[model samples]
Target: MQALLALSRAIDRLNTFVGKYSIWLIFAATFISAANAVVRKVFDTSSNGFLEVQWYLFAWSFLIAAGYTLLNREHVRIDVLNSHLPKKVQIWIEILGVILFLTPVCVLIIWLCIPIVAERYATGEMSPNPGGLIRWPVWVALPAGFALLLLQGWSELIKCVAFLKGLGPDPTVKADAKSAEEELVEALRQHQAAAGKAP
Candidate 1:
């Protein structure tokens, strides 16, 4: 049990690290998009590669951050009747859901994606659009993302079981950590304050 808890913590750490870095993909995509627009407008031309790369970056960010999102408990859920349930009951429901639904879905997706990714890579599949990027890199994200999500599902399952066994704290309680939106807003406020202080 302790070993499983340790594994869960490790998985949590891995996802946290991945989540922290994955956010940069969004910035990269944004920068590429702006640059592509500027080039198209000023130079009267743009490479499909540039445009496609933006999509790639966004896709990578979204897909690879699955485990991180799960770790942070940021995924959408309805609590209309859930909040009224007993804590243990809620945990039990979560355990069942993870075991019955999340695990199978993630595994199936990962299994399905593996062969596709391999085939694309093996064939050196390129985008049909001229000057666009290769397809494999983006294709790889599907399996990679779902694998992370699957690992996270197991991590969450471990945590849920540990809590049920009185070996750990409640797994469903939201930590006091600031959400990504909150952090972004705070940074913007700081930047505004700094600009105001400037000449």
Candidate 2:
């Protein structure tokens, strides 16, 4: 059980690291998009490469951050009924979800995508658009993201089991940290307070 717990922690760390750095991709995409728009309007020129790169970056950020989203318990859930259940029932539901649904779906996607990505890479597939980027780089994200999600699913399953055995904390309970929206609202309030005080 200790070994399994260690493995779970390792998976959590891996997803956390990936998720933290993936935000840079969003910034890169935004910058490239703004630059592309400016260049198109001001210079009367644009390239598909720049536009496609932005798309690629956006895809990478969205795909890679999925496991991290799951880790933070940020994924959408219809807890209207589940919320009323006992803690043990909730944990069991989570375990069943990870085992029966998440794992199989992730594994299937990863399995199906490997050949597609490989073929694209081997063929040096390029976008049909003039001056567009290679296809394989974006294709690779499919399996990579699913693989990360699979690992995180396993980690979550382990945590659920550990909770069942009374060996660790409840996996269903969310951390006490504020969500991004909550933090943003608080920051806005603080800024308003500071501005009022200054004037």
Candidate 3:
């Protein structure tokens, strides 16, 4: 239990770092896109591959932050029903979801995307953007994202098995206090996302 708690703490600290900066990346991407738009409309001179850059930034932002979100327990949960189930049933559902569903999905995506990205890289596929604008490879994100998901999935599986044995989830040893800083950050994120804004 202590070992699990130590591991979870390490991951959570790493998660805090990842999650904190993820918003900043989103902000930077949004700024880049807005600047590109203004340059095109007002100055009539903009990046040739700005649109593709936007897509890649958005994609990378979401995918790269996947594991951190899991570590924070911030992912959506269909717990209205599960919350009412017995402890054993709850563990089973969680185990099934993590092992059978989440892991498989990530594995399949990684398996499928790696080769596609390789083909693209090998052939030097360029975006349709003007000026022969070259694209940074989108392939890197796929394998990286899946790898993070896989690690977190393994962590969750271990903790869940311990949980089934009544050892509890990740043995979160930290005191559960909601800090003001956390609340403020969350509030701001919600506000920005809702307005199609980023920060």
Candidate 4:
């Protein structure tokens, strides 16, 4: 139990850290782009150097939060069909989906992206904006973001395995004997209070 709690806490802390930093990236991207656009239009200047910075920040903002979203269970799911199934059956479907679809997709993306990015690095790839504004280094976002996502995926896979083992955070913890006793006491107290109010 202690080990489980500790592991959960550590993952939660890491998720929080990523979330906080990713917000700054989002705000920085928004702030700089708006400010630069205003200055460019009003003052008649080209947004050359600042453009690259904005691209990098935009990439950071968009991709880095993926893992955080996974951690929070905030990503959308199509549950219209699954809701009719029994809880255990739903879990089985989810487990198979993760193993067959989600995990493989993430793994394949990272697998392909690593070599692609490395080739860019080896050839000293730079932004192709030419005389435009930003030097768009396309590879910055994928590696870091996907690595965190991979980690998050592994943790969720662990959670699913634990559920299969009948050991993850149990839904029936509140249905234990001690909780039933407390509920009975509370019900009696409430009944007595109601009875007192009657007459």
CA lDDT scores, all candidates in order: 0.92, 0.94, 0.73, 0.70
lDDT, model 3, position 104: 91
Candidate 4 at 119: error in angstroms? 2.1
Which stretch of 10 consecutive residues in model 2 shows the poorest summed lDDT?
Answer: 170-179
Could you give the candidate ranking by lDDT, starting with the highest? 2, 1, 3, 4
Q: Write the per-residue lDDT of candidate 3 for residues 46-143, one digit (tens) a residue.
A: 77577676777777778878987776666777778877887778767777888889999999998988888878878887877575444436667878
TM-score of each: 0.88, 0.89, 0.74, 0.72
By descending TM-score, how would the candidates be arranged?
Answer: 2, 1, 3, 4
Q: What value of lDDT does candidate 1 attain over all alpha carbons?
A: 0.92
lDDT of 1 at 172: 90
lDDT assessment of candidate 4: 0.70
Q: Model 1 — TM-score against the truth?
A: 0.88
Backbone clashes in candidate 1 total 0
Candidate 4 to truth, TM: 0.72
Worst 10 residues of 4 by lDDT: 169-178
lDDT of 3 at 181: 98
Candidate 2 residues lying further than 4 Å off, grouped into runs, are 177-199
Candidate number of the best TM-score: 2
Candidate that scores best on lDDT: 2
- Candidate 4: give the clashing pairs: 127-136
Collision count for each candidate, in order: 0, 0, 0, 1
User: Which regions of candidate 4 are displaced past 4 Å?
Assistant: 1-9, 131-138, 170-199
Write the residue-wise lDDT of candidate 2 on 1-199 in tens digits: 9999999999999999999999999999999999999999999999999999999999999998999999989999999999999999999999999989999999999999999999999999999999999999999889999899999999999999999999999887677677789999999999999999995
